[model samples]
Target: MSSKDYYPMETKGSPKSYSPHKNGNLMDKSSSEQTEKFLPVIEPGLDSLNKNPEDVDFIPVDHTPPDRYRLVFFIMVVHGIGILMPWNMLINAKQYFEEYKLGKNETEVVELKGKFMFYLGIFSQVPNFVMSGINTFCQCGGQASPRRIIISISIMIVVFITTVILAMVDSSDWSVEFFWITMMTAVILNMATGVYQNSTFGLAAILPMKYTNAIVLGTNFSGVFIAVINIICIISAPDPRTQAIYYFVCAIAVLLIAFDAYFLLPLTKFYQHHRAMVRRQQNTSGPSRSFQETCALFGQVLKKIWVQALCVWFIFFVTLTIFPGIWSNVTKKDFPIENKYWTAIFCFLSFNVFAFLGNIVSEWKKIPGPRFVWIPVLLRGLFIPFFLFCRFEVENKVRTFPILIDNDYVYIVGGVLLAFTSGYYSSLTMMYGPKLVEPEVAGIAGMIMAFCLVMGITTGVNFSLAVASMAIQ
Candidate 1:
């Protein structure tokens, strides 16, 4: 059949003819009745205006659909925020656990106080990392869908609801029991969140790269929200119980909103169109893969994007190593500012705000490019020592090493740089990972990067314990 026979035009009749592109766009046949229109849909690399472009196909320009109101982008951002909500809520309300629930007596304080934070870190990261690895391969084996995302969020909602109830009930009489119960909640919450987070990165990878960056922005924005809330709680001086209740309830509300946003994803033409393109690229009618096929694809994707994976891993490793664990303890009691406000404003608030801004900057400019992004990622190791040499209040141990960066202003500036680079390089490396591989397995590539990201956080959090120990005595 001729091209005209397959793609016939309207003959100035009742209504204009239209054909839907594979990407769900409508092509107007009346305008091109006499001649066919084609555009170069491939990247310019091999040959220009050649008879046959290398592994490229040309389609009408109308095949591309616009992201209406940027709804899909915004929804992905919301999911991004939801991904980190559980962890942020737990950490932001540290005082409620450390002081109110676990610090009923001197003995409790001496025994359970340090262990609470330590165990919290371990339980949260360990399950999260393991589940992320498990979920990554599971998704690669054709179980990738919004159902898992919804189910994971539902589990977290239930866990947070239980936490809210526990926060309201007084646990002072049974502080030790309360500590174990709280640890159980942390374990359950992180497991669900791990699946939720990896699925989000995988879904976003199939879309445009900016959508992936949007998730990074949302994650950082989650931190900014919690930090701001923390400052407000400090100023209002809410009781620990009251603050904990509000924090858990607010997290529930965010999850509910995200739950609603996800239902809207299928209705968005932009999302559906790109999703269809990914299917067509892979030459698959459905998400189906044998275990052996998934294993082979995983190997191929890892081979292509391993460098970017390392970059993402090292970036977060440096970040989690010094953050909250070390930086949160650095006190400025000698200055006029209250030690609480200093940590709130400089450490929590500044890091989050600058980090969010850094995510924004990364979207606009990708300096150093993907190939050399590792240079900056490695250089972030300096932050470990930079914060270490500052005035950190090591518990019950005198510092053998003198504080070199004693100036408060200098320390704050260093924190700003640290936070900004964490956000910027993180976005760059994550966005780069999926793009390095072919479209069919790009989602798998994103999952590998996410798994590595979790691995980085897990190792860094545990490593911070060592750094804290050696910093003084």
Candidate 2:
């Protein structure tokens, strides 16, 4: 509901300053002094808000029709995929990068590449972290925030243009100048990636928890699809150059599909209905969050669900640090998989599929609520060192760690547990966090969650790069 629900609000201020249609258009507004009026701040608790079940425009997940549910799920997953596809390309194309782009020898290339790529990846996360961190303030309201939708579509345009440029470029002719230019393009692509990713999470926050889950699931799905493509291209292509070309072509195609899905999402009946209901509800009250008030709202949200907030950060941090960052470097030359970072792709696939499965399993089972959520999630830290040691790394100048768990099966098992816990627990936290307060503040909770999620990911990338840069050699 819009601030109108709190309508007939007896504010002490003389003027107010919020006006925007749900479609993301700007409306003429009075002077900013209107916000100076004394409005009662929001208190915690659904009872405090004086809102009823029917008052909320969107259907509750349990009551929603199966068809609409599926549609929401599909859009979330597709957008999720698009948001992280750039990361996927960077991770899976390690072989191409290691061979053509990096150091002279296998040892130097593998060790240094992980650190370099992680550094680059984290640079991209800055925008995602910054934009999502203050999403509630940036958004006008849950329904009428046209800025988020416009930002989402605009980023798509930039990313799409970048993809086309990449596809048309012939890297074989690249020099030092051209290579750095390519890197600059990557930076822009990743920066745009962060903007949309956070926008999506913010958008989903305004919807039900299931839609959020769907978007998170889409990220892992993107990873799996990218891994599969990596495997197929490696097997089918004549050389690394061909594989690189295939990667670019397929990236453009996948991005196009993701954009189409996002474009169609608003046209669906369920989306329109939900939006209209939110708009209608707000007619009773005008949007009234000011800069200071927005900050206070964020603080309120953080205080309520800090546990879930921390867990979400740790989950991604651990997962992000280990899987490809360290995995890309460690290779047993004598091992059966006689390829560079092939094991990394395998590990990537394993984690994505298992994580997706865990998200699905959450439909029926949610063990150890907030009480024990932190414990198991904390234990996941072991995965970083475990997955690290499992790979072939230099023990010293002359020798390497014994390849004890060289079998693919062992990595597969590790991936399953890691991913399952990551997906299930993370989903549970997000699904429950928003419900802790009034529905009006749910979007704020979601924005915070997205911030924490990206923060964890950004930190994880840093840890992987910093630590592995020292140890991998």
Candidate 3:
């Protein structure tokens, strides 16, 4: 039939055409009998995209330029860097901040170094808790534009300027207020990291599962990148102030690259084709469902897939609670050779590297990461005690808990496991969560998973103080 003469088989309630599944889906009835005109099982509201269900706009798998797998990977890596790099650089570049912003001379900074480290840990997580709620609202309201990158870039530029100022000025000569302003600006930018991260994951969710994997991998890459920079600077840089400047210059440059990637992403044929189709339907199909409608749309799917949500949350919760915050405090030099800041940065690097491996490892192992993951997630709490025993409050080095491992190698091993399992299982949870429902709401499922992961980060950050306290005790 011509387009104008079409009866559009997608219409519901034709008794002869469809067999209603107990779930809300409808399947073609006649396939079993013979040559039947039955349509494939799909979500009820999804038919609005096409008057005929048979011609669903498939987002052709085009791994070309802009939307190429590597480009997607790069964008996500930049996205990941945006999420964690600011906070980490600030916290890890502790000596520089202490001397420059806090107005401590080298002698005083050395004397109170442990206190600074401890406080930076606490300061970083505070924003994670605050931003999660704001992000949920941002996601639900929907970003009509790529404002996430805009906000991030603008904030980052201001932060970059402040860092340059802090780098050049003598802290003692500069007003204490200026130093506080700089410190607060970094914290604020780090706090706002999730805004862009949430937007990045949401964009990736609308793409294929491989794209989603790319986003996750990118995040780990951020950690690895920051760790490497800090390690190199610690070993090579003569002045702490210069090291801080290097970190800021790199961070600012990275923000520009992320903006470029974000800008280029939509130009790809892969992105263009999908987006054009979606936009066309949205224009002709009346207003899309409200956030409440979406919530209701996938409420049942979410119930069935609660484990996926929990796994996402717990994996991150376990990670945030122990890593960077508590883990960075453990002192270590080069494994066999003594090197400055190698212990903290290396531990951080181990987590990110292993996590990246875990994400990719899914290709070889046919392991369903979501299955039986909660058990190990529950056991991860035990990592706190193990890592605590290896940590010291002493200015030089001293183990607090002597019950188990006193060796730095123990910390390295524990960090590896912590990073690896987190990467592996979180990847699996995200991959499988979208399959819990019909393909139409698969995007919603993925978005929900990302939201829960953000929630997990917030929860972990909030729990960090308690975990840190209990670990030290």
Model 3 lDDT per residue over 143-217, tens place: 222565567667766777677776787756444455446547756775666566665665666566666777777
Candidate 3: list runs displaced more than 4 Å: 1-70, 98-118, 138-145, 173-183, 276-295, 298-301, 332-335, 394-403, 470-473
| Superposed Cα RMSD, model 2 | 9.3
Candidate 2, residue 210: how far the Cα is off, in Å: 1.5
lDDT of each: 0.77, 0.63, 0.62
Model 1 TM-score relative to the real fold: 0.85
Using lDDT as the measure, which candidate wins? Answer: 1
**Candidates 1 and 2, the one with greater lDDT:** 1
Model 3, residue 149: distance off in Å is: 3.1
Global CA lDDT computed for model 3: 0.62
- Candidate 1's displacement at residue 420, Å, is 0.4
Worst 10 residues of 3 by lDDT: 38-47
Error of 2 at 333 (Å): 7.5
